[model samples]
Target: MGTKEQLLCLLESNRERYVSGEKLAEAIGVSRNAVWKAVNALRAEGYEIDAVTNKGYALSQENDLLSPQGIERFLPRDHPFNLIVRKLVDSTNDEARRRAIEGAPEGTVVVAEGQTAGKGRRGKEFFSPTATGIYLSIVLRPALQADRAQYLTTAAAVACAQAIEHVAGKQASIKWVNDIYCNGKKVAGILTEGAVDMESGCFDHAVLGIGVNVKPPAEGFPAPLGDIAGSVCDADEKALRNRLVAEVLDRFWGLYRHLPDRSFYDEYRRRCFLLGEPIVITRDESRVRARAVDLTEDFKLVVELPDKTRLELPYGEVSTAHA
Candidate 1:
């Protein structure tokens, strides 16, 4: 933490009472003048730290940014992952890929406040604006093989939904592969990409990129999506980012450890919204519209067609009709 952040934390911890400048200086091992400067810096950042000469400073209740410190305060005391926070990046997934190549351990997470080149499924460019949402990626090396890779996306969806519910106290339904929806509007998205060395028994790593539009757009949503997409904090800038991040990490830690358990599979299947719903699978020229029925543990989709014929499709092959 920087000097300003340390001072902010001290004032926030003592929000109920005013802490004297001399006491803050002694606690933070800095001069009283240094503490005063730090308080000034914090106040500039939209924090309501009231500096009363001789009496000391008080952090007035103010808007909190979705920065590292705000997010970290909500995390468990001993989290499994480090908060590798960055101001801006081309992509968090890209950063995680670089770290994974350098022999980074599992559970390493890379979070960027903004991404200039965010990506979605099938190389689609996703829009990520500054401090408007969560742009993060988690690095993992699951024991499953390529055939079972899509389940990671499913695991991610359930974790996200559970986290959202924990934060918003509202349930979110999963959209087949990598999207989470609430009130029939898009709220979150996940992208899972990994590489494997064919000769080696172990896989390289997989990076799950997640982006949630927390606040409603000020501008620049694609023309086609203007009427459909919405954010959780569209009405409130002070969104559920902090709580959701904590809940997501907590949920993932539990599931990742017991991934081989059948209960994990059961839980994911139960939350799949596409199952038993009418859907369309359009791949360029071919479109197969049917009722989505089941998703195997290996992440294959079994759909029953209009003619009562059954088609077993891979989860990778389709998009669904609107909810």
Candidate 2:
């Protein structure tokens, strides 16, 4: 770690109190001038650092900027994540895919403050504005067949819902497949992409991309998404973005480690808001009205058609049907 990173780690660890420039300089083996420079640099990058005569410098509790140090502070000491934080990227999924192709290990995570071309399910664009959302992708080299990849998305949705509720103190529900809703509006989305080993018929690697709208944009959402989109919280809180990122990673990893056991399946089913509700299943050019009944063991949606014909849908866009 460089001077800036070291300073950041120290400041984050002592967020509850101030650290004098003399103490900081001595701890990092740097001069007071260097410490001052680092503090100013962090401020330029949106960190809130208070400088007082006797108290020296203190990081504001409200500094919500995303940083590797900030996230690591909340993660367990034995966590398996190799975290990378970027100010901007085209897409975290794209970045993780590139890293995976180059042989990045499992548990490598790429987090971006903003994404120029954030991705969504079925080639859709996930709106990612800087300073208001969390966009991250994790590289996983699961030893599973290609056909079982849907489990990754299922696990991620449950993890996200749990994290949102823990941090934002709100009820989060899942709209079957991979969308998370809060207060009846879409707050998060998960897109799982991967490459398969052609000969072995197993996944070489999978990238799980999760994007969350932590707060509404300053000018509000775009007109097209105004009615359907929402944020995790009504207003920004102290370290809200960093906390959400850490919580999501912590919860997701807990489920991912025991993926074969399917321990989170029950929670996923309980949080699914579409169960037993009339829904429209859209596949290709056709839309069928069906009542969602239950989820199969593998996470497929079990629906009852109008003629009482039961069907299991492996993948499709679903929406609540209106009268």
Candidate 3:
């Protein structure tokens, strides 16, 4: 742990009361001046730390700041993953790809405050602004063969839905493949991309990118997305971000360790939004209007078309005619 993290741990450990600067400096083996600098830095990062003349400092319980220190406190004491927090990035998924190519271990996570080029399925642009959402990507090297890789996206959707429910205390549902919804509006999206070794026919690594609208933009969403886009919650920004990230990693890692089995299938299907609903699937120049009937074992959407035929569509943009 660095000086800032050490100081944060001390304050977080004693969040209810003041911890003397002298004692903090002694515990962390730093001078009082260094402690003051650390406090100032933390304050700049949105931590609400109190300082008085006689009393040293007390960290407010609602010190909702998104940082390595804040996230680490909520994570297990001895986590094995490498967590990279960035102020800005083109995309967390892109960053994870760069890291994976350079041999970043499985479970490495990249989180950014903002994304300049956020992405969604079918090459769509996800509306990502600064500081009001959760943008993160996780790197995984599963032992399964390349054909089974699609399950990762399914697992990611389930993990994200569960995490959102756990943190926001609200129910969340999922669209066919990667979109998560709350109250019938799109609140989050998942994009899963994989790199394969041609000769071995196995995946080199896979990156799962997730973006959730935790808070609304000051000006609200753009005209194109304004009608469909929505936030998962309007709670304290930093506290929600920290808890959501930790919970997602915890839930994802647990399901990932048992991949190809897809034990989350039952829960995932239960939370699906399009089951037995009239829908349209668009691909290139083709479009199919159908009734979504079920989600299959392989994560495909089973639908009944106007021709009275059952079709299992693997991927497409599903939208209700009524919407």
Candidate 4:
């Protein structure tokens, strides 16, 4: 750990409690000036640290910056994952994919404060404006067939919904395969891309990209998304982003250890916002109106169409007027 991380650990371990600069320097074996500089750096990164003239420094319960130290504090000391945070990126998913191609191991994470070219499902451009949203992607190498890659997206949806609900104190629901909704509007999206080994019919690696609207952009969303796009909370943006990211990674890893099973299916079905609701599924030029009934153990969506036909679809662009 570097000086800033060491300082962060000390301050975080004693959250909202005063820890003198002298004590921090002594604990980290750094000069007092180094501690002061580290504190200033953390503050610049959006950490809410309070410095008292005589007493010490106190870390607030909430921090806005997505510090690796802050995130690691919630994980094990030897957490196997490799995490990378960027001030800006074209897209975390793209970056993770490039790294994966270069032999990046599973559980490698790429997060950006802003994405210039973030993507949604079906090649749609996800609107990622500045630091108000979380744009993250994780690299995974699951020992499964390429056909089952959708399971990663399903797993991410469950993980994201649970994490948002837990950290934001708001109810979150899954919309079929890739969307998360809160307060009757879409709040998050998941995009899972797989790199397949053609000869083996297996996935070499998968990049799961996630974007959550934690707070609205300064001028709000574009006119095209005015009706559906929305944010999850108005609380501290940095705090929510850090907590949501950490919780999603932790929870997803726990569920992933037992994959190719139905452990996460029931919970996913329970939180699905589209369940029992009328929806329209668009694939190419075909549009089908159906009532989403349930999700199968294999992550397929079961819907009852208008003509009383039951169909199972693995992918589609979902829209509904129910909300």
Backbone clashes per model, in order?
A: 0, 0, 0, 1
Residue range 226-304, candidate 4, lDDT tens digits: 9989998874454667767888889888888888885898888888778788998887898767888878788788889
Worst 10 residues of 4 by lDDT: 234-243
Error of 3 at 125 (Å): 1.5
Report the C-alpha lDDT of model 3 over 1-323, residue by residue, as the tens digit: 87888998888778679989999999999999999999999888877999988889998776655666656666887776688888789989999999999999998999888899998887888888877888999998887677776688888889999999999887999888888999888999999888999999888999999999988888899997989999987744445687788888888888998877789999889998899899887878887788999888988899998998998887778788586
By TM-score, the candidates rank as: 2, 3, 4, 1
TM-score of 2: 0.98
**Candidate 3 lDDT score at position 87:** 78
Q: Which stretches of model 1 miss by more than 4 angstroms? A: 8-19, 41-62, 237-239
Best candidate, TM-score: 2
Off by over 4 Å in 2: none
Clashing pairs in 2: none
C-alpha lDDT (0 to 100) for residue 309 of candidate 1: 95
- Model 2 over residues 1-323: C-alpha lDDT tens digits? 88889999999999889999999999999999999999989999999998889998888988888999999989999999999999999999999999999999999999999999999988899999999999999999998888888889999999999999999898999998999999989999999999999999889999999999998899999978998999998765556888889999999999888898889999999999999999998888899899999999999999999999999888889999972
Model 3, residue 247: displacement in angstroms? Answer: 0.6
Query: What is the lDDT of every predicted structure here?
Result: 0.76, 0.93, 0.85, 0.85
TM-score of each: 0.88, 0.98, 0.94, 0.92
